[model samples]
Target: MPPIRYRVQANGPLRGTAVIQGAKNAALPMIGAALLASSGQTVLRNVPTITDVANAVELARAVGAHVEHHPADRLLIIDASTVTSPLLPGDLTRRFRGSVLFLSSLLYRCGEVIYEGAGGCNLGTRGLDWHYRGLVRLGARIEEKAGTIHITLGATAAADLYLDTPSHTGTENLMIAAATTPGRTVIENAALEPEVVDVARFLTAMGAHIDGAGTGRITVEGVDQLHATDYTVMPDRIDAGVLCMAAGITGGTVQLVGGDVLDAFGVARHKLEQMGVTLRPEGAVTTASRLGDLHPINIITDTHPGFATDLQPPLMALATQASGTSYIRERIHDARYALASELTKLGASIVIEGERATVIGATELRGDTVTAHDLRTGVSLILAGLVAHGETVIENGRMIERGHADLVARLRALGAHISREELPDTTRP
Candidate 1:
């Protein structure tokens, strides 16, 4: 297959309005949650038209569910009434991490599941110990055979679950597994991400009794069954943050429609303000603009209600144009500094030691070819390309497409000179 690449040109003062897509983080898990319904069709509205969601649909079909997707309406209808497969395809599961979410529903519906493990971006060690421990406590037996994992559940009953860290997927997995269990389940140190809250709301709409979703502690009362229903996914906060940074990096003005940026960005909004990005929120619209020089700011990535690790890479790209040095400490992913080397390719001065990275600003960035190691890093390179001295070509554009929907089109609408192209495969000898 041909590789996908992004061709970006230096376009200044991007001025326009762009609509944010539905949250990818929320939509993936909800697809798995929808499979918990034994009958009827589960309809998801506002779903992002991304590769990850398409992969989820394929995985759902592999497990015997009938799925229909409407990209024009951003709607997905899933009917798991005929789901009887216990095996998850290794090809699909190895492509994305959201595949792990289907474990709970498959175990609940088929009593057992054979999975080939989960895979996503190479962001250091993202172990599944928390998810396994939570599932084991909830009466599921898990075993590793060869390179695959075999999980079985017999008469599932609720139990107390605790996570060493408030993992987003861990909390969602446990909540989904406990939704149809016999008793009440308490999850301690639950993830407080808005995506998790959206998943909780989707599960709630399906008749799952959940409380304290956006808190550190969440309690779920298991019901005998879950009914399919229609639910709307929330707007993508990470997408909003990236677009806002795009405006900041190009010294432009843009209005983001579909979500409240002030509340969605949490502390990151204040950090953007600290860096001289003006953000004004009115209802579902937030206007982001920068009329002056960009400033430097310190940031520490955390779980929820804090600086998001996903947004750190774009912020690093933005810091390159700042007047001074900006310090970013990545506490979430150890290998997130992988972006520093790629940024340096564009003439940005960055020093990385351990999980701490120091970005020196006011460096003249000249466009060059770079690689997108992950989704966030891919978008960060695009941000750099927006303000670069010349044309910038970003390889491995699929990474950016995994999370952001209509990214190039949306950026073009906002006056960014970016286009996606597919390079023909040249590996033939």
Candidate 2:
């Protein structure tokens, strides 16, 4: 497969309406659970055409699900009715971190799991020690060597699984494992992100006993079988936030529909309001713009109900154009500030001190070549490029599509100077 690269041109004040897709952060684990559901078909609607989804589809196939993707229709039908085993292809698992989700789902179905180390963003050490510890507490035996995790379920029963920290995926993996273990499972200090609630809703619809989703404590009463059902996932809040920020940073008016403000970004919405951005009530379209001549304010990242780590990169891009120094602290992912080097390429003054970042607002940015280290970083480069005075070509855009769908076309509709570009040669010398 050819690696897709984007050559985003600078054209803003970007302005246009965009409907958010089903949350990628939420959809992956739900798709993973489809693997362990009773022998039946599950249809996931509003699926995004991102690399992460592709990885999930690959996971479905590896675990014996008949997976079909209709990108044009935005539907991914996964038929796991005939799943015969818990063994996932190690090669496919190595490509993405979402693969670790199979650990819990497989343990539910097969009582054993052997898989490769999960991989994703290289921000910092993504140790699965917490996940392993949680699983062990739930009575699963674990053996590891050479980057592969071998798990065998012992006396399956519910237990109190306290997250060393409420690691988002860690809590999720534990939830999936405990959902069918025939006993009550209590998870404390669990991640309460909207995505977590979405998964819980899906599991409950499938007959799992889960309570207190989106709260610090969650209870799951294990059941023997989960039924198949059609589900519409919640809107992508991060995508909505990015588009809204794009509108504000470029001084354009755009009404974003199909998203609930309080459900996904309530905390960020409050912060945006503090910075003078207005968000209409539920079912009302929202718009973004500058608060007079002075820039709004500074922000720091945290877990859910705080400025999202996912939105911090683009927020930094927007902050660069603000009038005052904006402080961004990433409490979740430390290495998310890799974009500072690329932002510097565009003549933005951003200083990084460990996990914290400070952006000295700039009135103008000059276009330059930049590399996207990850998904959000790639989109941030596009946002900065759009606000620049000249053309900007973003290389290695594969990172962008790993999360956002139709990003180039959406920017194009918003009057961004952007287009997909092919590399010079398909064959290596």
Candidate 3:
């Protein structure tokens, strides 16, 4: 088939609830970590039915693990007891970037893993040097010969490893790698992303000793073994943030359901409040509504307890509707503003210069055809369409489906006029 497209027609505010899916970022690494358990079945609840998760399940099966994915019930049961492979499926691994997360688990289980290919979103150069160096510090022998990552597990567990940039995946890799080793593993400069903390909790529930999850420093005491555990992935905080922005930009009132009452998106909630958005976090759900007009708010993406880089796209879409110019400084990835020009197609006043972009708001956005380059930008385009004056068709919509499940249907349930359409495969013979 051709690239899937989303045709969204919007004329007013959205209503109803958005059921938050499990964090894709957290689930992928967690799926990889399942292999660390030598026996029993690992049950992951609230699993998001997205392409990335499906790819992860395929990766698990390719490695000789039995994975039963129940999208109807949002559950993934992984049986790694029968794992017999040390090589990640190159085709599958090359298709999804998170596949690299399996390296540590394979090293923990099989003592060696050879992966020749790794791919994901084109977020410029997210250096894997931090991961390689951190793993090496943890006593793993890592070598790249002929473009394949060859990791040989050290006989002894890593004592202390420090991440140079507090990379989210790197931190999780070290934590999972250290889980079964027989020593106390200390990770300084650990990523404080909420998903990282959730994965740490999941490992902890699986009998690994971990502490300082939400802080920059983490300690993981290795145990003799890890058993299968039933755990639920945390709600996708970025998804929750997108909905919150959806409400804010469209003058809509939406209650983001099944979240941790805005705890994970604490920084985003504050940022939205600064933009005159009314967000109330009570109990399990966080309700986001309008507080008159949106005001300008400048933000910079930083490590957790700070604004999230993933939220930048949708929030950038939100800024286009704010009353004044809202400045955003992206310190995470350089090429993330690929969506900025697409936003300009919708009549957004956005001037991007390198890592800094000035989004002048209170400008009326007229819907136009746009392309989504990545998962976050695809959803961001959808949010922009929800408030645009006319029909907005987003091409490359498969990018969004990679991370979000039933997004159009969910948004439709909220009274947002949107539908999915399959583009004719023009490249087929």
Identify the candidate with maximal TM-score: 1
Q: Any residue pairs clashing in model 1, and if so which?
A: none
lDDT for 332 (candidate 3):
87
Whole-model lDDT, model 2? 0.80
Candidate 1 local lDDT, 45-70, one digit each (tens): 99999989999999999999999999
Best-to-worst ranking by TM-score: 1, 3, 2
Off by over 4 Å in 3: none
- lDDT of every predicted structure (CA atoms): 0.93, 0.80, 0.88
Give per-residue CA lDDT, model 2, range 123-204, as digits (tens). Answer: 7766788889988988989998887788998987789889877778887888888888778999999998988988888888
Please report how far candidate 3 places residue 403 from its true position, in Å. Answer: 1.5
Q: Cα lDDT for residue 138, model 3?
A: 74
Better of 1 and 3 by lDDT: 1
Model 3: per-residue Cα lDDT at residue 144: 86
Locate the minimum summed-lDDT window of 10 residues in model 1: 258-267
Candidate 1: C-alpha lDDT: 0.93
Off by over 4 Å in 2: 282-284, 294-296, 424-429
Q: Give the clashing pairs for model 2.
A: 9-417
